[model samples]
Target: DARVTQTPRHKVTEMGQEVTMRCQPILGHNTVFWYRQTMMQGLELLAYFRNRAPLDDSGMPKDRFSAEMPDATLATLKIQPSEPRDSAVYFCASASTTQGGFSPLHFGNGTRLTVT
Candidate 1:
């Protein structure tokens, strides 16, 4: 079965440290998305890519956060000088388009981050 896989299921870091999250999208899927979930923000789409190319990332903080797809199957999100406020569960999801419509996104288990 197709599935999105994420690594380092949990992370804890001090303020100002660097944090990186990785994802392996389902094979043959052309779209990938990153989301951040928090009590205040609910679930926010931070970025999304189609055909392994970034389409938008306006919801992400450009100064310290970045999202990228290094290849067809791998995606990454990074935060530098991480702050306590950045702590949240980050999710990676992937989808494919069919003649009928777009397939529903398959989400990864998410990486829970904690900043001290």
Candidate 2:
């Protein structure tokens, strides 16, 4: 009955500050996803990995955001010199699927981040 867990459910920081968000994906799940939700992007997929191998992160801002997996149950997202436009809800998800890459993702409550 493992579940995805996220830290710092809410954060407010001035522009140009650093923000670190963390997530713990479900145990035994082989796929993980990072997504950002906003009115503009509309739940853009940021990054995904299976079996600790990165799949894609082209949707994320290459300059400020970075996502990584330190272990099977751990994932992290960091934003350096964040801007006001970067404000959004960041979610982490994991799934246990036999199929290749079409498994539905199970998302955490998400880290609600707001940059001033």
Candidate 3:
């Protein structure tokens, strides 16, 4: 089955700590997405990349969070000086695109992060 793989399924950190999450997207997919889920925000798209290139990341805090694709299969998200408000589940998803649109995305189980 085609699936996204993520590392460090859970993390607990004190405020001001740094947190890093990694993902491996399904092979042959050209689109990668990062999302954050919280009680207040529900599900918000943090970043979007096409063909391993970042398309948008305005939903995330620029000074604290960053997302990147080192290659086609790997995607990484990092948060520096993490805050209590950053406690949430982060998800990585992969999808194929057609005619500039997108196909159905396959999502990873998610990484649960807690910042105290």
| C-alpha TM-score for every candidate | 0.95, 0.92, 0.97
State how far residue 80 of model 3 sits from its true place (Å).
Answer: 0.3
Clashes of each: 0, 0, 0
Q: What tens digits encode model 2's per-residue C-alpha lDDT throughout 1-116?
A: 56799998999999999999999988888889999999886888999888878889898888998888988878889999899998999999999767555456788999999999
Give the number of colliding residue pairs in candidate 2: 0
Error of 3 at 49 (Å): 0.5
Off by over 4 Å in 2: none
Model 3 lowest lDDT segment of ten: 97-106
Ranking by TM-score: 3, 1, 2
Candidate 3 displacement at residue 65 in angstroms: 0.4
Model 2 error, position 30 (Å): 1.1
lDDT of each: 0.94, 0.89, 0.95
Kindly list the per-residue Cα lDDT of model 3 for residues 39-86, writing each as its tens digit. Answer: 897999999999988999999999999999999989999999899999
By TM-score, the best candidate is 3
> Which candidate should be chosen as best, given lDDT against the real structure?
3
lDDT of 3: 0.95
